[model samples]
Target chain A: MKTLYVQGNTWLHRLSPGLKLGGLAVFSLLLFATRSPVVLAAAVFLAGAIHASMRFGVVRTWQQLRVILLSISILTVFTLLLNGPADALAVFLRLVALAVLAATITATTSTAEFIDTITAGARPLERIGLVKAADLGLAIGLVVRFVPEVLARYEAIRDAHRARGLKQRPLTLAVPLIIQTLRHADEIAAAIDARGIRGQNNRKLGEGS
Target chain B: MATRDLVLAALFAAIIVALGLVPPIMLGFIPVPITAQSLGVMLAGVILGAKRGGLAVLLVLVLVAIGLPVLSGGRGGLATFVLPTAGYLVGWFFAAVAIGYCSERFVGRSQSALVQVTGFFMAAMIGGVVILHGLGILWLAYGTGTGLSTAFLGDLAFIPGDILKAAIAALAGRAVMVGYPLLPQRA
Candidate 1:
């Protein structure tokens, strides 16, 4: 997985993950509420200014944004045909502002920090017994770890196919990948059970009751 | 959820992201691509059943919300939420729910093999195609201002690919049925 986090100790880095995430949400809301091209354009400028503040340099900033830029361009072009230039501009400006602002924060914030913030945010629900905040953290952690494992497994499966002289199609790739992972899932659940990681929640619930 | 179920959900979420590494075929008319990830969504539902399946999709969305580029084409962040494809992306959750629920209700330990395959196939179509496309088209038409008929026509491009995915999910569900029986046994 490509990480957006860059090495920096800027003020954006100093801010809490909650603040950054909250601002991102509110910032999106602001973009959604406005129709004026002026406001939209300014939002774009604001996003640009934030990126410039990073001093990631033009190359680095462009590197981060080029893919997003392509899709945004596609949408803008399509909208131009369907809805005319005005809506097209609106579409482009809004996506740029949102994507840039989002990319900036993500670059500054590490995945650990992001997951921690989400876990903290879900604390209230934990208190009400709707969920275990710790399990939320655990689940996110497991997913973050599992993505790479799945990829590695995919590579191994491809290798196995190569050695066996089998043609690799999408279905062939997927079937083995899924079955192997599901088998691992059984072991993983057993491992978790052995370690008592998830059981902590149930034990706590029983104590509370 | 049980430990096995949570781990299973997380595992499926990982599979969804991995499937995304397969390059999506972008349609000339529509903004969204023909992604392999949706096939992962169908598999999650068919294999994991409803509760765990929906949880898997939700976990991915949470990853998306924090701006991880887990979507096909390395696109993530709030930018994706505003994309014309956002409708389908969000629709993934409901699609998984619909498929998983139908899988649970339709297939059983004692069911005939034909019933098992047919049931899983029907679930995938209802969830992966009907439910997902219904929401996806509506959002494209209204949210993106593309209008209904044009958007509907443009979305027709996805049908052939999506049907193939539904079939694959059904067959895989059948293949793995005996090994992993997630369907409830009635308490």
Candidate 2:
């Protein structure tokens, strides 16, 4: 989904997806473990600095963050109401910092890099018959391709409902949506079957047995 | 796994992400928006069964971890795992398994349509509402530094919407059962 990825060729874009993901994990863990507002504030500034260094322009970064920023803002009000200004401020800073830092990585890395890295990383588990790297990669690729298509279908369905002057009842929307999506899945499964992909898996298992 | 299973898992993973694009129905009481993605979780379980269903959700989580904005409200990345919603996200995997296991156990091929629908509804409620909310509230409290009781109190607002989702999941599950009968017939 383009909503998920922002294309760019900064220094951050050059790093391997594995390295980028690992670093993001460590950074998030540290943020979660630290409760201090000062540390979180500094983290926010550091995250911002990293984004600025990319020269990706603040506008695009903000564009990627519009929904998240609104969410954090709404959450800030709740935290303020439930806890206090100190907690609210800390929560806001932490969320903003993490979201921005994450946006930086997503903006830089390509989806292909992500899938390849995941497949490579999981290749080690093949020893136990628990991993099939190629299949895993293909599955991830299919998911990426289908998400937007499904979303478009959802819009079409919703439009149809609206045309009929149906109330925005979730039940009505969900029933048709679920049926259509599952039908699509069934077709894909049938297509795979026709392609003889499952034949390979069956033969491999037969040989192993 | 069969190639069909792999394709179904990926397809359901896409379904989960697609559900996130549905604009959340807000009730104004809770901070969390009423999103349709959770229904996708239930459907995955009901349609795919336990092992395949869990893998389907795990696939989505993997995509999210790699920084795809597949989550509701368009939020994703490693950062989401640290947020107050992290528990629900993590729970999605187990919830799928739990619901699928329950559905498979309680709703057999010989069962009547009414019984099958009831079974699906029960499975959805147990896993999607109870298990998911249990994990979600715990994480929300831990992440936000709120007391467990308070966090749970806040989560109460979601019950009404979640009940509706369970009902919808049940209806859809029954429809799939009649229309496609994807579950393998008894040996």
- Best candidate per lDDT, number? 1
| After superposition, candidate 1 runs with Cα above 4 Å error | A199-209, B22-35, B179-187
Per-residue C-alpha lDDT of model 1 across residues A148-191, encoded as one tens digit per residue = 88888988988898999986656667777888887776578677
- A60: Cα error in model 1, Å: 2.5
Q: Evaluate fnat for each of the predicted models and list the values in order.
A: 0.46, 0.45
TM-score, B chain, candidate 2? 0.89
What is candidate 1's lDDT per residue for B1-187, written digit by digit as tens?
Answer: 5676777788889999888876664544445655678889999899888888998998998888766788877877666676666789999999999999999899887888889999999999999999999999998776556688877887897888898889878888887776555433221
- Candidate RMSDs in Å, in order, are 4.1, 3.9
Over B1-187, each residue of candidate 2 has an lDDT whose tens digit, in order, gives 6665676788789988988878875433445556888888998888777878888999999888777878877777665665676788899998998988888887876888889899999998998899989998998888777679878988898877888788878888777767666544211
Span of ten consecutive residues with least summed lDDT in model 1 chain B = B178-187
What candidate 2 gets wrong by more than 4 Å, as runs, is A148-199, A203-209, B22-34, B182-187
What is the C-alpha local distance difference test score of each model?
Answer: 0.81, 0.78
TM-score of each: 0.88, 0.85
